[model samples]
Target: MIDDAENKEALTSFLQKLVNDSYEAELRRYSSLLATSSRLLTCDSIILVALSSIASLIVDGRVSISREAFIACVCVAALIGASILFSIICQWRIGYKDLASPGEQVKFVEKSWEKLSSDWNIAKSYSKTLDIMYKSVSSRNNKISVLLRISVALLGAALAILLILSLCMINRACAGA
Candidate 1:
């Protein structure tokens, strides 16, 4: 059992001193990135469903459109499908490294306690943990961010194609009239 004095010392040592202010800010940024990924997933899913529904309606004779426009719609739907895939991949699980399990950390400290010289250095121990976590989290973050960019780019291209196709259809309609 830990004495009251030792417990107090341990609590004080761990009080917000385990992580830097930078890391705290970085955690918020990471959370924002995850939220953005979710929004992308939602938007891509909606666009893909809408495009697919239109294509199906045209195929089933429930909707009538020019052959060129139908083909353009199908092609744009494919683009959105690809974007949806990327967004889903971005939403997949990414393992961010946290501190060691409590049991493991306690055991490590206990084993090293016998060799102690002056006192326990929580900062040094936490720094090493941060080093490992940074490497893992940063790499995962980079991959996720790249996937997000790809999804956004694909979605943009699909929208642009749809816009151009609409303009062409309008111009053709006016000329025919």
Candidate 2:
């Protein structure tokens, strides 16, 4: 009976430790997601600024921009920027929700481990669920990041084209006068 008691105590301790580790892992995953979301927001801002500058150049006659092309570019940039902003907001909320209270979770897990039979299988299952949640969040973040990068690239290319066109128009006007 004494040996059995010792074995149960050891198993309980091990299960508690596993829970603590899993909670920490979850917290780390949440933090990473937050960081990624912030990066995506910043990238979106940069794209917006570039697009605005392009618009200003065209308005001021610095770049000879075709009216239709300029309008189309603005519309496309706006759509992309808005969508990225929305995604970033959603990611932030998910990260916030997943953030674990280290002290509280540890205490809860310890209590549960003490009361429950030393079942490693239960702890393993919980850890697996946590892993799945982390992966899903990470995948969503990656998709948004990719979209932001593509939008930034498109905005940059459009700006360059506008600048060149504006310069050409100025040259033609000067020659004509």
Candidate 3:
């Protein structure tokens, strides 16, 4: 009887250790995901600020272009910037909002580990899907930011060229008269 009890206890200990180790690994992965999500949010904020600045310049008549084209560009940039901001907000709500309290996630993971010992595979699969979704959203955000930056550069260049040409035309008119 003594040997049987000892063997059972050893088995239980081994199982517990396995659960603990898996939970720790998962917790570490979640921490990394949180960090990456935060970084993406910050980058989106910076892009929005830049787009807003460009829109301001256009609204304030600094670009020296026809009202129609200026308004159109400003609208498009504003829409893209707003969409990016919205995406970041949604991702934060879905991925990181509950993780704000320190160590809460770790405790949750431990509890989950205890309850779902036999279902670790399912949990791991779900986690992988969530990670893929995060990456997809992050990639979309980066692409939109790049497009916005290119649009800003092209618009600025066009405005500058228009300004130079207008100045030349005015100079010619004055000289001819």
Candidate 4:
């Protein structure tokens, strides 16, 4: 037979723990999205460097290639660079999601404290917080997803263009042009 005040206090403590854990878990889920973006950025950088290095070698007279091949190399480098730029933008956006900000954290704590310490329900507060955070993450991730898609598409297009142009150059080489 617990008194009513003690029961209320115990419920508040339990709810506080549950809400905090839920919030932390939500933040943890975002880590996976960031990791995926990071891996994509790495791929973009590696391919850009490898392609540009080969292009530079040929373009600088270390190896002779036709003007068409030269053009292809230049185009490939530019396109890959563009892809990298977009990826960088995606990373920048990821860098500043609302939950990452100190001010937002403060606001969240204040709201949680107010709700959990008063007549307000912790579960309701957590529900609303989750919904708001989800919308924020979803909208930002949507844009980042779009940017990643564009980056991938551009890289593919650049590779295709280079392949087509390189094949033409190879034909010319075989014909002793």
Highest-lDDT candidate: 1
Point out where model 4 deviates above 4 Å.
1-29, 93-120
Evaluate all candidate structures by whole-model CA lDDT and list the values in order: 0.76, 0.62, 0.53, 0.72
Whole-model alpha-carbon lDDT for candidate 2: 0.62
Backbone clash pairs for candidate 2 read 63-166, 64-166
* Each model's Cα RMSD: 5.7, 6.9, 10.7, 5.9
Instruction: Give the top-scoring candidate (TM-score).
Output: 1
Please write out the lDDT profile of model 1 over residues 20-111, one tens digit for every residue.
65466566666777899889878878877777787788779998888888778877888888887887787777778888899998898888
Taking all chains together, each candidate's TM-score versus the true structure is 0.78, 0.51, 0.40, 0.65
Error of 2 at 17 (Å): 1.7
What is candidate 3's lDDT per residue for 1-177, written digit by digit as tens?
Answer: 224756656655665565456545555554555455455556556655765786688679786555655655555456545545544543442332222244865666576675545333334433553455445545544554454445445444544544665576587779989
Steric clash pairs (candidate 1):
none
**Who is ahead in lDDT, 1 or 2?**
1
Off by over 4 Å in 2: 1-3, 91-177
* Ranking of predictions according to TM-score: 1, 4, 2, 3
TM-score of 4: 0.65
lDDT of 3: 0.53
Q: Which stretch of 10 consecutive residues in model 2 shows the poorest summed lDDT?
A: 90-99
